[model samples]
Target: MKLRLGAGGTLRYGAGGTTDLDLPGDLTGQVVTVDLRHVDPGSDAGATALLSELIARGAARLVISGTDTASARALLASAQHDAPPSGLAA
Candidate 1:
């Protein structure tokens, strides 16, 4: 199964290219947890985008769980480094 975070804070999860569910909510100032254990390797772009969007939307923190935790952290760090400055106070 693959989990995708949509533009409008909707979570899409499914298998075989079919989205089976969408859980919608605001992510502002929230700590979001993402599990990427089942995600394919070498798909860092999507994960990076997700991290960027989360930070841009004011997520307080992120908890990433997967087989490649180190890589995930590195991705998040890169995303944070490349993220645009936000109006929200740190």
Candidate 2:
């Protein structure tokens, strides 16, 4: 499946653990928000893992512009925990 992470971030995920994040894609400056707070328990782990990887690779950043505070908090929390490397800079 393909998912667009607002503001130029994009990701592709498929079976067998194959995935890609960022990859020079464009978000078209559309400020869409994702409700991460209520992500089902089953998918939370995967979301966290994917966000961690995106941060690690400098492919994503935290931005707030939605009505869902809980979701923003969850995403921010994940970013903080992972803490992408400064030098990696994508």
Candidate 3:
């Protein structure tokens, strides 16, 4: 997990190539920017759970890169309403 600090103390987290992800409990309930580029999220228990945890963290914006996989695209779709304004694309 990589964090990008932004204006107003915003915490942005980038999770790249997450074949094995272990999200810390402390990160829960904290709004964060999640970048899942090049990560195959399908059926990965850790990845799926992490995504849900991020969403529950309060409107975390999800960003993806490269050829969008179905699971990755689903992640993008889940946050599409926030995409236009947040500039988060797949």
Best by TM-score: 1
- At residue 40, give the lDDT of candidate 3: 48
**Regions of model 1 farther than 4 Å from truth:** 1-26
lDDT of 3 by residue, 1-90 (tens): 454323332334554332433556444334554444334434334344445555544444544433347766765455443323322222
The alpha-carbon deviation from the true structure for residue 52 of candidate 2, after best TM-score superposition, in angstroms, is 1.1
Q: Given candidate 2, what's the lDDT at residue 53?
A: 51
Measured against the true structure, the TM-scores of the candidates, in listed sequence, are 0.67, 0.41, 0.36
- Model 1 residue 1 distance off true place after TM-score fit, in angstroms: 18
Top-down lDDT ranking: 1, 2, 3
Q: Over the stretch 1-90, how does candidate 2's per-residue lDDT look in tens digits?
A: 233332223334333323564433333222323333334444444555555554554544434433266755786687658755545534
Provide the global lDDT of candidate 1 against the true structure: 0.65
Q: Residue 80 of candidate 3: its Cα lDDT?
A: 43
Error of 2 at 25 (Å): 12
Clashes of each: 0, 0, 0
lDDT of 1 at 24: 38
Write down the lDDT that model 2 would get: 0.45
lDDT of 1 by residue, 1-90 (tens): 245544343455554324645433345667777666655667666777777767776778887776476797798898898766665666
